[model samples]
Target: MAMTKKIPDTIKGANTFCPGCGHGVVVRLIAEALEELGHADDAICAVAVGCSCLVNVALGIDKIGCPHGRASACAAGIKRVRPGNLVFSYQGDGDSLSIGLAETVYSAQRNEKFTQIIVNNGVFGMTGGQASPCTLIGQKTTTTVDGRSVNMSGVPLDIMKMFGQIESVAYLARGSVHDAQNILNTKRYIKKAFEAQMAGAGFSCVEILSPCPTNWHMEPVDSMERIAGVVSAYYPIGEIVTGGGLNA
Candidate 1:
């Protein structure tokens, strides 16, 4: 009989993210997936500024820090220079949807051969909880003290739909880590995104609806509930693309 192998010792340390922070969970999932797929050694992760900036410490993977919002461009450059390596980027909502919007859109437009993980925590957790591009309508943040108003702050950007419109994007999906089921689904999406990259299909982006307990001024458990009830309601979870299952 064959024996089930254990996860690598490299991923045993305490994560840097705060309690109820979804980044740590997602990072572990990605790391497990990489190990399972035997790409752990060849994977190169690029982390952007914001909450996800210190991804290197969380995941025992080869990681590089990119500029404030240039994770996608940096990932593209790495992939272009080292086509054999599995390249990915870990970015937060502020990093990817705000300052990094141009790079994200252009990379998808060009079908860059890489995978991007966008953690949409709604608020900027690392920088005083400012309202982010993915912040839900009527949600309150440091910048939106009285709830986000459409008149003041345009509608939240539906990044999945926006990138789905780009012909070059091969795989796009939105998932959440607010619940056990959604967490499983998020892992599935991450695996698919990695597979898409390995198959050289095109760009793949997985948007993860995460929680920021500290920013929300709520306890960890309450923050998770908020993500499930409010966050998921606004940003429904599911896959937007599959690259025609070419990667499978």
Candidate 2:
């Protein structure tokens, strides 16, 4: 009998994320995408503070830890200094949309040569579930136990649509990992982002609608369903930008 051998890859480590946390799934999908493109060795990832800061240990890649909301800037610098390597930034909603909004916007505006993966869980999971920029209307968090009110907190920012407005952004997509079909689509979108960057087409971003069971106060399975149902309903999953006439 022949034994099946497990291939050595970047995601060969203990699971560090909470149960039902979507960050691990997103990281695994990204690693698989990197392997599929044969760019794992040449890839440099910048991680931001919050739940995604420990992704370096999870993915075991050439990663650098950046301050809250600065992963895009770090990734931009890395790509500029080492244009030969593939660069990507992994950030959470609080990191990317709240504190790092300026960096994220500027990088996209300038068309930085890198990819950005934004995990939108709608709250600051690492900091006791504070409401974030992507928190949906009527959603409850630690800070907003009565549910988010548009009058008090305003509305969730449409990040994908905002990035789509920038001509420098070559590709932009929003995906979810709540279902098998969505998971497969998310994988495909991530792979496309890698390919686009490798082809030097400019910046690309994939916003993943992730789940936070701990903060949501739901069972793991229930949280997954909520992510698919409630979260996906608010943030529809699909490609928003396709590089226009530019080919990867």
Look at candidate 1 and tell me the lDDT of residue 79: 98
Superposed model 2: Cα runs more than 4 Å off = 1-8, 245-248
Residues 1-248 of candidate 2: C-alpha lDDT, one tens digit per residue: 99985643898687688988999889889988888888889999999998898697788679999989999999999999998898999999899999999999998898898999999999999988899988888888888889999999898988987887887678889999888899999999998887888788888999999889988888888988887787888788999887531552
Flag clash pairs in model 1.
none
| Runs of candidate 1 exceeding 4 Å displacement | 1-5, 10-12, 245-248
> Of the candidates shown, which would achieve the greatest TM-score relative to the real structure?
2
Where does candidate 2 clash, by residue pair?
A: none
What is the C-alpha local distance difference test score of candidate 1? Answer: 0.87
Candidate 2, residue 209: how far the Cα is off, in Å: 0.6
In model 1, the number of clashes is 0
Q: What TM-score quantifies how close candidate 2 is to the native fold?
A: 0.95
Provide the lowest-lDDT 10-residue window in model 2: 239-248
